[model samples]
Each structure stands twice: as structure tokens, then as C-alpha cells.
Target: MGKLQQFLTGLAACFGAILMGSLNVWPSYTLELYTDNTTTLLTAPMSEFESSLVGSLPSLGAMLGTGITGVIIDFFGRKRGAMLLILPIILCWIIIEFSSSSIPILIARFMGGVGGGANLVYAPIYISEMAEPSIRGSLASGTVSLYCLGALLSYLSGWFLSYGMIIWVNLSLCIAALVLLSIVVESPMFLLRQKNEQEALKALAHYRTGSTGSKSVLEELSLMKQQLLPPVELVSVNADAEANEEATEKEKLNTDEVVVVVPPKSSSLKLLLCACGGCVRTGANRRAAFTSNASCRAFLVVGTALTLQVMMGMIAVQVYAGTLFKQAAPDLSAHFCSALFALVLLAGGTVTGIVADKAGRRVLVISSSALVALCMGALGFLMQSGVAPAWVSAVVILVYCFCFNFGAGSVPYVLLAEVFTSEVQGIASMILVEWVWLLNFVLIAVFPFMKSLMGVHGAFYVFACVAVANTILSYINIPETKGLSNKQIQEVLHPKVDKQNSIDASLSVCQKAVFQEP
Candidate 1:
């Protein structure tokens, strides 16, 4: 029952993910419709430049949406903020359904991008908060799996349904998603942060499928409080010490026993740095988490993973699936082949979600990334030689999709939500996701130019190289985070200094002191 309730909430989040996935591939199938001269749906056939705008504009809008996620999620609360975020998607479809020209549809796509970008952060955060640690990886990755489901559905819909019908279908799904989100309770952690203890307990109980007074529910709530709140006694002690120290400093100044000197340039620089770090938090816990060396290292890992994830060419393939298929297999139906690609994504993501807890994040990512590199390298050879059978190229592409999703598609997101404490999760996620959207915009916008300049084989070669590098990095850097609590993960990231290193440092200090005294 506890798992059921959590699944239901995750299912709500999945609905939004589905919309994002569909939007991602919408241009893949619809670009032809707008660009075809015989089509009556547009004022005129879209120019090459206009078509690229249609395909890439959402990513730019996503950047804007991701940048503002901390503000929206923090201000509105996760549940309500997600519900409010759905409004833009709904509005996006409405504009598309009514508009006859490219400009309004472009505007609508940007709005949809905003909703999609926010979901990239919101769904992972919401699911991670509501799920038990045992099942967190599955629920989190399930969202990505479902995003593939959305893309698969969109491919089929675009193949079979009319443009107007596709618009209405998405609109209906948006309404259904909003309804599901309403049924779920607010995130228990969000409530705890807001200091609504009673409500937090109730929310936790709802998710746990137990009464607030139950031992399991109470214990879990207590654990969340411990993780999120600073120790009150420690805070008070620090406050009193600071007060006494300030008084002593004032006395010294009055007696002329000490002189204070401030450098304006250094003071201004220090203030700027502090203000930059402080933007994420005002509380002690959040400030420490945001400014910690451990968090910075984790961010570096996530950032590099995210860069590799984008550079590996999945976004380009997803956005241009039909075109790629048409090029590779002129005899096969491109639409069917594109749907096949999405199906592979769905299968790989679902399998990853099911086994992530058992196999662990590091192993899955390292092994699958190696396979991705192999398949991509094979595809490049097939494309460059022009001698391989059409089926060989198609098979290699499908295999690449499956291998990419097996780990790369979903694991980094799990890491993003897992590595940070709740204090800095919102801001950290925003910054990382914003980076992703910016990459999406640049890659998607330039992919056509790249294909024209370097040829498809060249692009595949570039992606293969990136996948190889990613595999190496994941093997060396990614920690095994399976079944560990957030605190345990943090300890792994920021372990205690070795006793031998500590002793050697002490001896070195003593030696320095002796030499200086002489």
C-alpha cells in the first residue's frame, strides 16, 4: 500500500514527462507538414530558417523556464508549482490549435518549452522526495521511461492522426495530467521545510499509506526533519559565542589595544563572493550545503556527465528521427522506423528503472556507455562506407538507442537529485538543468548545419568519441550510490581525512614550528 501511494504520485509526475517527450519529437513528424507546399494548415510552406526556429525555439524557452525553477518551486511548493506549470502547456496547445500562421505556433512551442524545461527539474525532485529510498531509483527512472512512452505515442499519432487531431490529443492529455497532480498530496519534505510539522506528518502518512501515529510513519518523518533542519542547540551555541567575541573586539578597540585595517578592493571582492553563494540560501544548513567542497565536486561530476549526455547525440537523433531513418532506409517507412527508435528508448529506460537498485548506478552507466560507444562507432562505419546493407545501419541505430537509455538517459538525473542535500537540491537542480537546456538549444539548432557540413557519418563519429570519453569518466568518477541514504552518499563524496595523512600533517606542522622558533 505504501508503494502504491508513492507510485500513484509518481504516475502523476510521469504524465507531465510524457508531454515533454511528445513535445521533443513533435517537430520530427510535423516539420514536413509545415514545409510541404500542398499543406493548407499553414499560411505558406516554411523556409529552411523558419523550420529550424520551429524545431529549436522550445529549447531556448526551456532555458528560461529552467533558470526560474528555484523561484517557482520554492515559492509555490512542489505540488502546486507543478500544477501551475501545466497551464503553459495547455495554453501552448490552444494557440497551436487555433493559429493559422507560423509565428503563433512558434510562440506556442516556446511556452510548451517552458513547461517541459521546468518538468526536467520538478518531476525528479517531487518523486525523490515522496518515494522510499529502496524504490527511489525506480520511480525516478520510471519518469524517463514514461517520457519515452510519450515520444513513441507522438510518433504514432503524427503518422496516423491529422495535425489538428494531434493538437487536441495533447490538450486532452494535459488536462488529465493536471487532474492526476491534484489527487496527489504535497511533497512531505516541502511541507517540513515550510515548518508545517502537522501537515508534513499527514502528508507523509498519506504517502506511506499509514496513520501519522504509526511507528514507521513517525520514524520517517523524524528522519526527514533531522536531515533538513540544523541542530538547534548547535546554532544557539554558535550564536552566543559570536556575540561574546564581538563584545571582546569592541572592548579592544575602545582601549586602543588593537587596530583594524580594511582594504576596499579585497572587501568588495569578499562581499561579491558571499552574496553569490548566499543567493541559494539564508539558513545555516542550506548555506553550508551550497558552499561545501563536496557539493562543488558533485556538481562537477554531474556537469560533466550532463555534457557528455548531450554531446552523445541522443537529442539530435530524437529530434531528427524521421529524417535519419529516411536517409538510412529509403525502402522502409520512416515513421515506423522512428517509432521503433522510441520503442527502443522505452524498453531500455524501463529495464534500467527495474534493475537500477539491484545493479547499481555506476555499473549500469559504465557498461551501457561502453556499449553505446561501440554501437555508435559501428553506425559511423556503416554510414561512412556506404557498403553495408540498409538493415545493418537501421539495426545499429536501434541498438544505440537502447544502450544509450540503459543508463545515460536516466542515471545522471537520478544522481542529480540524489547527490545533494535537500537544502540545495532546488538550486543545484536548476543550474544543472539550465545547462542541459542550453546544450539542447545549441545542439539542436546546429545539428542540421553539422550534417550539411560534416555529413551524417561525421556527426556519428563525433558522438562515438564522446560516448567513449563518457564511459571512461563514469568508470573513474561515479560512486556506487545504490541503497544508500542521502547522508551516506554525502559521506562517500566528502569522506573523513585519512588518519595517516592527519598524523603526517601534524608532524610537518611541528617541524615548521621548530624551524621558525629558531
Candidate 2:
């Protein structure tokens, strides 16, 4: 029952992703329709500038969406924030359905992009927070699969459906997604942070499918509380220790014996210094994630992975797949080949989600990155040599898509979902996702220039090099978070000192300070 509930929650979260996917691909097929005078969809056939805006407006809106979404999710809570995002997408379809002019349609596309951009940030965070550790990766990876499914739906819809019909279909999808999102439970961690312990427990049990009083659910809730709310007594102890010196000076003038306030039952100042130097902390007992050394390091690691994910040319490749297919196989229809491309992407994503937990993140990312490099290298070599048949380049491109999706395509999102402390995950996701959207805009814009300057083969070589770099980085920096709780993962990020040793050392220092000869 817990598994069923979790599955439903993940599916609900992915509706945003589905909407985003369809938005991304909508321009691909509709651009020609809007520009052709024969089509009755627009008041006038769009000029070159207007048509470009129709296609590019969404990216700009996505940039705006990424900027504000972090605050929304944190303030409104993930479930409500996700549902709220769907409104813009619904409005997008409605505007398109009623408007005959290109300006309104262009505005609609931008609104759709806003929703899509928010999805990239919110869906992963919600799924990661709600899922049990054992299946967290699998559930998080579902976003990619469902996004591809949406893209595939758009491709088919554009090929067969009329303009008005496509609008109706997508609007219906957005409405349904909103309805489904309404029923899923709020994130247990968010509930705990609100100090709603009983509600948090029930939410966790619903997702975990355990009794509220069950040991597993209770233990998990306790860990969450430890992370969310530190002990108030420890803060008071620190306060007392600071005032001890003033008290001692006053007592020295008034009494024969100077009373000393013993330190709290934790580690000494020296141990704290050592842990700080080592960048280790025990659970969420640390400072804000942005201020903490451990979290900063984790951010660097995730930032590098995301940079590499974009540099590997996944977006550029997808955008240009039809061109590549047409060059290599003139016999095959480009639209049909594009549908195949979307299907292959869906297949790779599905496989990753199923195997993510069993295979572990590090292994999948490392191995798949290496394979992506190999395929890109071979594709570039074949295209350059001109000795291989045209079909060989086509086959290599398809294989590259599969290999890329197997790891480079999806795992960074999984890592993004899990790496940061909850304190900073929202803002961190916004920053990193904004970076991704910016890169998507930059890469897609510059790719044609790159192909012209370096030639298509040269661009492939560049992508190959990026894949190799990512492979090395992932192996060296990324920790295996599979089946690890948040506390355990943080401990991995910042190794804690031995509790007994820290206590004994702290005690000895306190004794010496209090009893020394004067």
C-alpha cells in the first residue's frame, strides 16, 4: 500500500514534467503551420521575426519561471506549488484555443514555458522529499521518463491533430494533472518543519505504508525532527558558557571559591574546531546550508555535474536529430525519425528509473558517461572519415541518444534531488536549474555556429571530450546515496568525530581549566 501511494505521488508530480515536455516540442511541428498562409490558425502568416519569437519566447519565460519558483515552492509547500504551476500551462492552451493572432499565441507559449521551467525545479524536489530512501532514485528518475512521454505525445499530436484539437488535448492534460496533484499527501519533511509531528507521522506512514505507531515510521520521523529542529538546550548551554567568564570575575571578588559552569555533554571546543576543519557535521545540527563548508562542497560537486550534463550536448543533439537523420538517411522521413528519437529517449529513461536503485548512481553515471563518450567519438570519426556508410552515422547518433539517457541525461537530476540539505535545496535547485535553462538557450543558439565553424564532426569531438570529463568527475566526487537516509548522507558529506573521544577530550579540558593552581 505504501508503494502504491508513493507511485501515485511520483506520477502526480510528473504531470508538470509532462506539460513541460509537450511545451518544449510544440514549436517543432507547429512553426511551419503558423507561417504557412494555407493554414487558417493565424490572422496573418507570421513574419520571420514573429515566428522566431513564437519559438524562442518559451525559453525566456522559463528563465523567468526558474528565477521565482524556488521561493514559491518553499513558501507554498511543494504539492501546492506544483499544482499552482499548472495554471499558466492551462491558460496557455486556453489562449491558443481562442486567439486567431500570432501575438496571443506567442504569449501563450511563454506562459507554457513558465510552467515547464517550474516543473524542472519542483517535481524532483517533491518526489525526493516524499519517497522512501530505498526507492528515492527510482521515483526521482520518473520525471525524465514522463517528460519524454509528453514530448512523444506532442510529436504524434502535431502529426495528426488539427491546431484546435491539439490545444484541447493539451489543455485537458493540464487540467487532469492539476486534479491528480491535489490528492497526494504533502511532504513529510515539510510537515515536520512546521512542527506538526502527528501530521508528519501520518504523512510518512501513508507514503511508507506503515502504521503511524510502527517502528520504521516513528524512527524516520524522529530522524527528520533531529534534522529540522536542533536541541534548544544546547543553544542555552553555549549561552551559559559565554557568560561563565564574567561570572567568575564577579565571584572571585565576592567568594573564596570560584564556581565553574561545566560545558554541555557534547564535544570540546577543540573537537568542534577539528570537525570544522574536516568539514564534517552530525546531521542537521549544523548552520544554514549556504554557510556550511560541507554543503558548499556538495554544491560545487553538483554544479560541476550539471555543467557537464549540458556541455555533453544532449539538448543540441535532440534539437538537431532530425537534421542529422536527414543527412544520413534521405530515404527516411525526418518527422518519423524524430518520433523514433523521442521513443528511444523514453526507453532509456524508463530503464534508468527501474535500475537506478539496484545499479547505484555512481556506477550508472560513470559507465553511461564513458559509453556516451565512445559513441560520440566514433560518430565524429565516422563522419570525418567518409569511409563509413551514411547509415553508420545515423546508427551512432541513435546509440548516443540511448547511452546519454542511460546516465548523463537523467542522473544529475537524481543527484540534484538528493545532494543538498533541505535547508538550502529550494534555493540551490533554483540557481542550478536557472543555470541549466540558460545553458540550454546558449547551447541551442550557438550550436549551428559551432557546426559551421568546427564542422558537425568537430562539434561531436567537443561533446566527446565533455563526456570524458564528466566521467572522471563523477567517479571522484559523487558519493553513493542509495538507501542512505538524509543524516547518513550528510555524515558521508561531513565525517563526524567519534562521540566518546570527543566527550572525554572535552571533559579533560574543562577539568584542567577549572582546577588549575592559581
Candidate 3:
């Protein structure tokens, strides 16, 4: 296969993964409403605790699901792990659609949450591994786009159908997803790492050549052999070291000129600090500092961006949109208005992916923050005046969603995944995703009370402040990650600072004496 073919196959696989993964989040928007309404219609009276429990159970389940699945992605391999999740998701959908009681519904949603959480970890890792270097940003951005699509689908379903119908529709989507999964190939990296050389070669050939003759297959195999060589040598060294130091030395010698040198225990802490510090420093601390610094900064920026964006966009809007809409247009249906809010969110997420790679994450985030703040400020003013038209209110809300997704929503996951080394990619992505879910939980829980106490307009003004803060932080603290290699991103995020003079000034007599000895 040519480069374009390889890219297209990878892109197809990524799109599929995201589509299935996002299927998990689509039900969240309407699940609470559905649960509450269904319970009230069926039972005599539902308590506040029961209502809250039905609404919040899925999120609690999702937190546990993601935490457990995050640690297992690297072990099970991304493709197999993802495939395993489909069964539970499908089963959950079936139970939710057919089961009678609220308890069954909660269990079903919890099972679905497990699938959703696993998808959050697995889809990005699979996409990042499969994607070509040049188009990786675009591909990574697709994951968020698909997630938004899921949200949109949920909103549309709620707008058009009853609760039972929504459940059936989701069930159908999951069934179709399972059928599609059977055709997709496993990740070549997983096979290679497992020492299934023949299978790995076959998979790579399929990825690279589509279908070719023996000579071409042999050529591809040769290239894979060379590419797989470093890991093989490293594995041998590790295995031999477990046997004895002398065996390790012999194995290292056998690996031609490549030497596997293990540093002393005393150097480990410096290595850790340097790795965690930033990416630009060189010498012994360079590799450690580079990976550590890059991953940490990326996590901080991406996690903060996701948390703030979702808090402002989904949490704030869900809590206050009804009051604000009523104040702006007493005649319009609040349910329809909420559905419109969801549509704008979908539009923002979908469109942002189209331009994110070209515009760059830092620029997109900063610009989006400014736009969101503007729209939010306008929303506050218009709500306070009580004179804004329904159409005007709708436009402002749509524009707010657009700006939020166009900037922060599309960029966070892409930047986080791209800014880390391959060795820690799974764990690093998990950390950021876990933070996103946690912040989402906090925002969802607190926004209603905040809105009640502060009023609709006041709540939005608070979100606007957050946007401005995010913009300033992006400008001062976050570096651009677009089109940069993981190592290069690490370097950019942690530019070198001259600390030698400060060190000299702060040194104590004993430290100075130690420095003199060095």
C-alpha cells in the first residue's frame, strides 16, 4: 500500500473506534430526564434521593470503570481491549431497554459506563499508534468530534422521541457497532511487542501493502525486522539481567555496538526530576526531564482546559439555560431550547476538528476562550435586560458552544496524547481523561446550587472569568503542540532557564564545598 492507503486505513480505524466509544456518552444528556419521568409515571411517588441517585449513578460507575480500565489498556492491547468492551455495552443497552425496574436501569447504565470509560482510554491510544506522524493531530481531534456527535445524537433523540424509544435507538447503534468490529485488524505494535513476529509481519503487510506478492511481502518483513530490532535487544537485556549480571553483559555484547547501560541508584532521583521538570535540558537528566516535563505540563494544560470548558459549556448551561431562556423568551419551550443548546455544542465539536491542526492548539484555545467570554458576557447582559429576542438568545448560545468546542474541546486530548512519550502514553492519557471526568462530575453537581444562589446571569459571569483566566494561562504557560514530535513538544513546553547563578548564590558552606569537590 502507498502512504495515502496506509493513512486512510488508519483513519477509518480511528473513526470507527471513536464512533463506538462516543456511543457511550450520547445517553447521558437525557438519561436523568428519562429516569425521573419513567420513575414518576410508574411508581406512586419518587423521593429526591431516588431521583438524584438515578441521575448520578452512571457518573459514579464511569469513574470506577475508567480507573480500572486505564491501568489495563497497555496489558490487554488496545484493539482486543476495545473489542472486549463491546459485549458489556451491548448487554447493558439491552437490559436498559427491556428491564422493568429502576435498579436494573442503574445497573445497565453502570455497565455502559464501564464501556464508556474504557473507550476514553483505548480509542486515543489506538488512534495515536495507528496514525501517520503528519496527520496525527487531525486524527486525534476526530475522537472529540465523535464524542460530540454522540452528545448531539442523544439530544436529538430526546427532542424527537420518548424515553423508551431513545433506549431502543441506542441499543440498535450498539448492535451495529459490534458487527463492524469484527472486520478491523489488531494493532501491529501489540503483535510486535508480543513477539508474534510472523503475525505482526502479516498485519504490517496488510496495513502497508493491502495485498501484495511474496517479494513485496519479504521486503516489508525485512523493514519490520529492522524496526522491531531495538525492542528485541532491550527485551533480551532485561531478561538476561534477571538471570545474572554476567548474562546481561554477554547479551549486551551480542547486540553488536548497542550497549544497555543501567545507571546507578543515586542518579535515579535526578533523572526523575529532570524528566519531570521539562524537555530542553541535556546530558544525563535530558531524557528523564524531557519525558517527565512534557507529559506533566501537557496534562496540566489539557486537564485544566477540559475541566473549565465542560464546566462552562455543559454544566453551566444545563443548570441555568431554562431560567435564562424564560427570562429572555417566556413563550418558547424550555425543552426545545435545551435541545438547541445541545445542537450548537455538536456543531462546535464537529467544526473545530476541521481547523484545529491548521490553526494550532494554543491559538485555537486562546481565541476560543476570548470568544466564549464575549458570548457569555453578552448572555449575562441580555438575560439581565429581559428584552432579548428568542432568536438572539439562541444565536448567543450557539455561538458560545461553537467557540468553546472550536478552541478547548478539540485541542485538549490531541495535545495531551501528542506531548507524551510512547512508553507512558497509555498512563498519561488516562490521567488527563480521569481529570476531565472528575471535573465534569464536580461541575455537574455544583452548578445547579451555584446558579440558584448567584442567579443565571451571575453564574455566566463567573464562567466568563474562567475563560479569561484560561486565555491568560494559555498565553503565559502553555506551549503550542501542533506538528511537533513528542520530544520536540517536551522541549518547547520546558524551555531552558539559567539557574546556575541562583544556585551559587543560595549555596551553603557545605554545599559550596561539595560543589568545589565536583
Candidate with the greatest lDDT versus the true structure: 2
Candidate 2 local lDDT, 333-429, one digit each (tens): 7668878888888989988899998999999899989999999899889888998888888888888888888787888888888876676677777
Q: Candidate 2 has which clashing residue pairs, if any?
A: none
Candidate 1 or 3, higher TM-score?
1
lDDT of 3 at 95: 83
What TM-scores do the predictions have?
Answer: 0.84, 0.86, 0.76
Candidate 1 vs candidate 3, lDDT winner: 1
Candidate 3 lDDT score at position 268: 27
Runs off by more than 4 Å, candidate 2: 231-292, 495-518
Candidate 1, position 319, lDDT? 60
**Mind giving the per-residue lDDT tens digits that candidate 1 earns over 69-129?**
6788888998889988888889999998888888999899999988887888888888878
The TM-score of candidate 3 is 0.76
Candidate 3: tens digits of C-alpha lDDT, residues 1-518 = 44554445444334433434344444445445545655443443345565456556656666776677655655676665666666666777788667656677668767777666666666677666555445667767766666666656666676677877876777776666555555556666667667886777666666654554467656655644543342211112222234554564455335443333222222323433455554334434322322335545555666677676676655557555666567667787756666666667667766666676677778888898888889888988877786867558757877887788777767776775576555556666666677777887888778778768987778888888888887887787767776765456767765455676322222221222222322
Clashing residue pairs in candidate 1, if any? none
**Candidate lDDT values, in order:** 0.78, 0.79, 0.61
- Residue 371 in model 1: shift from native, Å? 0.1
What lDDT score is found at residue 105 in candidate 3? 67
